[model samples]
Target: MNANPKILLYILMISALGINTPLSIVGIISQIAEYFNTSIAISGLYVSSFTFTIAICGLFIPVLFSKYNRKRTFVSILTVFAISNIAIIFTKSIYIASFFRILSAIFYPAFISIALTVCEEIAPKGEEQDYITKILLGISIGSIVGLPITTGLGTIFNYQVAMSWIFAINLLSLILIIIFFPKIKGKAKSYEMPFSSLKSKEFLLATIGIMMMPIGASIVYNYQPYFLQVVSHVYTYKLSIFLFIYGLFSIFGTWLGGKLIAKRDKATILIFQLICGGVFVLLYLFANYLIPVLILILIFGILDGMGYNLIQYIESSVIPDSPELANGVFLSILNGGIALGIAIGGFLVDGFGIMSIFIFGALFLLLAFIILYYIIGIMKMPLKYS
Candidate 1:
């Protein structure tokens, strides 16, 4: 069945907003800590727990649900997601809030995987990447626009209000999905096993390389609110503005990644990692200066957006025969990396200081650069230019 392109885009964008609702809480984590009478590190678990649940669930959700009706499954998942967000609105403790976050995250990977599959199915020949890029724009916009706005709400009113905002958006998405999303049939029972794609050495190496990028980036990003408060002396009101600007540039970066990856995938990603590492190091060196910090935020935001799409492009390229499985593994590893980054960042915050996380971020990117180089350079894997 042919789906209306505009309606499909709306569905994808709204679903992404719902998926990213938990992340919008990052800016108010300090308030959460104070509310629960806990440490900042513990308060950070609200983000980490959600990401970690997605990581584990992503590994198997696609494979388990591959034969289910895509439209029905997606609608059902969003319903549960809405319920989880509403539960968070009433929770009085950080730990309870985190538990509901985890419950909501259980369906996230499957939702993303199905969305990617639907995009691929409808994309005309030779235009798959463009379609993929459009869907990823939904993700970028959710981060760039949704995140800062919800963060501002939480800052102005309270966390419950922020969560209510998320619930409202998600509810709208559910209504749209029920009305406009096309009914796409699932794969046949005899479809190839998802794990079949993991047997390739190139795919495995590419996954590892992509995983490192998030771990590196999240080390700094997960604690950005606290970092800005302590190191840059950015007030809570101003923090949302800075995040909004960072997100604006990030949208550009996402678009740029789609454009550049088509020409020179390996070279583009390699240079991005190298420059990203340098930018992190620079962030550490100039942490105390507002001018340099603003510049770096713009640069890092772009790099951050580029990383999201480039990594997905590479992952799918390595295992072209299994897009659903590849996308699932990509989400799993990506969020797994984020969880790891948060853990590592928490350690640094407790021991060295928040500024130290940037240095460690640079180190992780260096490692990603090395593995990526090894795959394209030493292993001589043929680059597929779409």
Candidate 2:
């Protein structure tokens, strides 16, 4: 059974839907706060709780159901995600809405873990990254297409309507998965969870290597709207357009990262960190200028975009045979970064200023880059050459 492109598209789209459900609120966080009659600090908890739930699930879901049917699990989880989005519309309070978010989060690892492993499984050996790129492209769509559109809807109608937009996307993904996905029933044999995965010093360093940039990225991400408002004075619909541009360029970055991964995996990642770190610094400098700020956002978005592929590629390479463990840790730490950033950003925004988030993000990235370079230099980890 050769890997079919059409089937791969189905897998990628479905995986994107699973992941993007939580992201539906990206640009609309502030709006959600107003709608829920809460403070921005409290509203920030949505992203934190959502990511933290995924972090917790990422550590365990892979081990618990290593043998389960990947296709069925994918479909089942999307079904739950779809149901949750629909149910969220009926919830009368933030508490109920948050419950649905947490509930949907549990299924995130199921799709992501399955998607990565399946991409590897269905690829024509050694071309797995090519398939992985297709999925990452789908993720980029969330920023470019899904998020902007959903946020736009929120700007126009309300958050409920924005959620309905997500519901629509999830529905499309669910239908496509069942129709086009290959039926690989039954479990994968030879599942292995090496305790050495935790004990490996090099692996831990590499994991932390990519982790810092994401922490910084999330600091900006979770509070971008607030920053844009303070910096460029763009609001609502106009803001979503800039975000769309930010997401659109990220696709190019994804393509670039995919190509570079073929050559200098770790080096390419480190270079991106340095570039993104600088971009974060520029965000602070150019905050007062509209055109320059938007351009910087584009550069930041592209680097951030490349980062998704780089992180997953490195994590999977660390434990090639164990897809769940690899992807599980990938999702865990990545979301852990987002959770931590949002948590800390709440304090920064409330105490310091909106601009402080970017400064903090920049510092985090620079520090991470320094540490990553030292680790790679000392450990002499072979990630493809210069």
Candidate 3:
């Protein structure tokens, strides 16, 4: 794949975008809280808002880009994403920071959708999944690199300084994307509308799967620091160490996910992985000691990463001809679930206690599993709905 200049450039740019944004910032949530003199829960809202925009913008991006020039559309989105990160660096108030975050989130889904489409457009027809997986690996790398970079930067400079570092990285990455991505000779056939496919059973099921997996994943992620501080009595430095370990091992899980999809059906992998995800959420809830918490989170991240990739693969499978729209819708539902999970988990943490957040996440995922199972079973029936 390195022999292909476009593919190499695509991976580099996407990896920077993915790594430099959310995961990097998540490692600094407490630092953000300290900087703004706000509660950590409120600081968590910055991450949640990023997810909210990604979800809400899913419905409009495909339609908006359908009529726009692909290269300009992508370049514009990347510019917006980079500029918003700059806005984030300068904002003093948490609310203002969150506002910029939401703005940044708007352009993200569009860029991601376009990137996947670009991969497909470049691939040798039958190898779409291969290209798509390699592209998605950027997200995996982001999760890996973002954590360490955030922690290391935070250790040296303040949270705002760390945010600035990520922004600079994004600016450099966007420049690279502008330089290397090939220009389209004319409007591609991919610009066609894809709204009709939203109603398909497979598409709908894949959407639900994407939504639920994050609910389960975020329950743990949202409260991980609290889990370490309160349950494990681990200090901030130790917590960062555990987080680094989680990021490191998760690369294997992500790789495993791509390998699994290459060997089997996407829907089957998503269903099984989601069920395991729920189980991991429950395990995380009950974990109290430092060792158990560390072990479970590592397990959780690995499983969640695998489940996340499978969810995307399933969505790509739903509308194989339109991976752009399918991936957009997939990202939208997934982000919605993430926001919902954080909000719901916050409520549970306050009302029922920290462990209850895990219960709530597990329940939401179980609900998704049941819904998809019924939907899949019904789709096998003789009668068909249009």
Give the number of the best model, judged by TM-score. Answer: 1
Q: Model 3, range 1-386, lDDT digits (tens) per residue? A: 23474565465446435533565577677888988899988987776677677788876776466556656776677687677777777877888788777777777777777666667667775665566666666777775777678766876788877887777767776676577655543244445665677677666765775577778677767787786787678777777777777766776777677666666653555366465655566565567555665767787777666765666766666676665677787777677776777777778888888777667667766766676666555564111111
For residues 1-386, what per-residue lDDT tens digits would candidate 1 score against the true structure?
77776568657867876677666676688767766778988987666677778888887777677788888988898898888887778878777777778887888887887787788777777666666777777777876677777777887887778778889988988888899888888888524664655777887888888888999999988787788888778886588678778888988898888788877777897899899999999988888898898899789999998887777877777777666766778788878887889889989999998888889999999999999899887987766563
| Model 1: pairs clashing at backbone N, Cα or C within 3 Å | none
Give model 3's TM-score versus the native structure. Answer: 0.82
True-structure lDDT of candidate 1: 0.80
> Which ten contiguous residues of candidate 3 have the minimum total lDDT?
377-386
Q: What order do you get sorting by TM-score, best first?
A: 1, 2, 3
Candidate 2 positional error at 361, Å: 2.3
lDDT of 3 at 344: 79
Model 2 Cα displacement at 346 (Å)? Answer: 3.6
Best-fitting candidate, scored by lDDT: 1
Of 1 and 2, the candidate ahead on lDDT is 1
* Candidate 1 off by > 4 Å: 30-43, 90-100, 190-196, 223-232, 284-289, 383-386
